[model samples]
Target: MDKAEKDQQDDSQDKMVLESVSGRRLSYDMKTPFYGDCRDVDDFKKLNRVGEGTYGVVYRVNDTKTGRICALKRIRMEGETDGLPLSSLREIMILKRMRNRNIVNVTDVAVGPQLESIFLVMEYCEQDMGTLMDAVPTPYTPSEVKCLMLQLLEGLNYCHKNYIIHRDLKLSNLLLTREGILKIGKLKFPDAQHQTHGIDLIVLFAADFGLARTLSFPSKPMTPKVVTLWYRAPELLYGDAHYTTAVDMWSVGCIFGELMKHKPLLPGNTEQKEIELIVNLIGSPSDAIWPGYSKLPFAKTLNIPKQEYVRVYMQSKPESFFHHTENAPLLSSFNNLKLEFPRATEHTLSLLSGLLTYNPKARLNVKQALRHPYFIESPRPLDPSLLPTYPEIRNQVSEKEKNRRAHDEERKKRLAHEGNDSIFSADHYKKRRKD
Candidate 1:
């Protein structure tokens, strides 16, 4: 064939491809469907931003073709940048693999010029647990608390079965939907190739996927970083290299306490400060409760300023920091010294104490935690759909942790089919599912 004839055929294929100016390689942007494509701003016009979290800013959007309104999370890039942010990539990778009614849903992704800033499109929700907690005239009612807790535990359980852990779990991180479903978000950071803060971090949020590692059967020594310092378990406190899901359980306990009391039980300003509070309340750990604490890589050099080692620092803080207050209406007249659940159910207090236990092995994990009396005989069953007041937040699909989400989603499907919806769609995340 003549060059003129060959050029005509090449033009047809080149119409859909882009030849790199520097290299011989070619790349395809997307395959077009019957719906006509556009290079104009009408494709997706940005509305006002609804919320902003640690990693990026989120904006409400209008999808031109379907006229559907969705959320667009545009994470800020550092320099030209460290590629895609781990949190954004991790959420995408994990959410795509996980499918369940309870976990936040991730619908699509969009990229800006030269992939300058990656944009994630997600389902839209109106509120989060943190905002709701403040909205309600009353904190969570006994029944509402029971419902939220059940779902939270179940979701955590599902994640555990898949060998995934949400180091950052809090009320503010929970998204409540118009449908009344409560989901979690922000699961991708730890595994990001480019990340900051690892072993010596003060808390679990800092212990993002960037610090995440797999657990071997025989087990290997791990670090103390992963979960936030205040939510950290005692096993980790004493520095256990061979930590497991118990680390997360400890954070659950702290979060539970906050939900019940409307405040953090061990509200240490820093990891070191939090450790002292845990130790002061629980009185430090021994080998019995957390078997291999002494063997952890950081254990040999645990740096908490114990009273015995640093008496001056011990005298500085006030004791009222750990005091609990009730969820009911109160004034200056009500005693601040009382426990939040002043007349809290015996089992309720027991469940709280059990999880808040300093020792890792002894800490109530998701499995055993599910059996806790708090869920079995609480005032109500866990059901996110029941709560009317707390709003919900939607999750973007482009975060990391994609590899582990498949196992998590499969387990969620099994649980939902068995009628345990709350377990998979509970309170936490902060990446509960897709946020």
Candidate 2:
């Protein structure tokens, strides 16, 4: 079933008694055939392929029953695997618990009848932010940029609240609906939605929870799940495994800077060079202000002693900030973009600064981060009803509506229960051997 169906069921189940009221009795019949693993899902015809990801291919499918439009993420089997992959299971688990405008929602998941593929049904999104950013030629106004930042912060705030951290927060992960509503499109957010934001009419959304992780109450250091090189945060460069939600906050800061500059602030190819580029743009780490700098795994190898470096990189040449809009105030480098985007005003910047601070301890927690002026004082407020939207979203909702979370869970457990026999497992050697 799809997400909407599951929600309706969940709503009804909320009122139902937890005690068991029904049980299935196994009976042998001469004519009745027992369909178990041999009988897979026999629903929903395959439609056009939409996109591909690290694990599978996405298709724009039509639900035969409701004639609904939905995006189906098909999980490929690695041959003879009876169950689903852990990534697929986790994605289902996370999507089930997550309900927000900025996060992508899963509506349905079904196994192919032949056990050939698994399908993930989600709200059909038109485009991704990265594609839109490249496709849309009109530059963003300061107000528009603020609108986007507020939505992203709000979404991030939600994840932090739930102890979840989206490690892969990049442009490609944001998506957009056809009508321009940022439906947590691509990484997540619409291309052009006139969302009510105080005096403005624009909103942004954060998408892609594939790389997200949850922390415990006290929070513990996590694995170095670094995003792409361009969006990698500073602490990750130092090999800090015991990081907190601050790591995601740093990602937010990086994305905020990009929204303003229309370019990646610190685009590095290697860990060493990445730090070198960051230190060049924001200046290298200093023990004086960043006391624990020298102790970092990478910091101990700094060639420069005393760390007397400029805020901007020593090699970076000062350049005038381009005005994307006419009659707009001049933007000083990215360091001061918060000034240009009111949503990123002083308090917001301060909060973001803490996230990007050389010292992780100085970073803001989820609660503290949301309290930042960017979110608290922003003119635009997050409204959930303004979600799953796009020009086509409403039309697609009727047919696409199913409880994807529950369906995903069933498929996930089925996949897990099957283990190595699961087709979702990756095999780099497949093509080589086939050739």
Which sections of candidate 2 miss by over 4 Å?
Answer: 1-42, 76-82, 85-91, 114-116, 179-208, 217-221, 302-355, 365-370, 374-435
Candidate 1 residue 388 Cα shift, in angstroms, is 3.4
lDDT of 2 by residue, 77-157 (tens): 444343443233334434544677766676644554344445556777666666656545565554555566666666677
* Candidate 2: 10-residue stretch with minimal lDDT: 17-26
Give the TM-scores of the predictions, in the order they appear.
0.63, 0.61
RMSDs, each prediction? 18.5, 15.5
Superposed by TM-score, candidate 1 places the C-alpha of residue 181 at a distance from the truth, in angstroms, of 1.6
lDDT of 2: 0.52
> In model 2, what lDDT does residue 38 have?
13
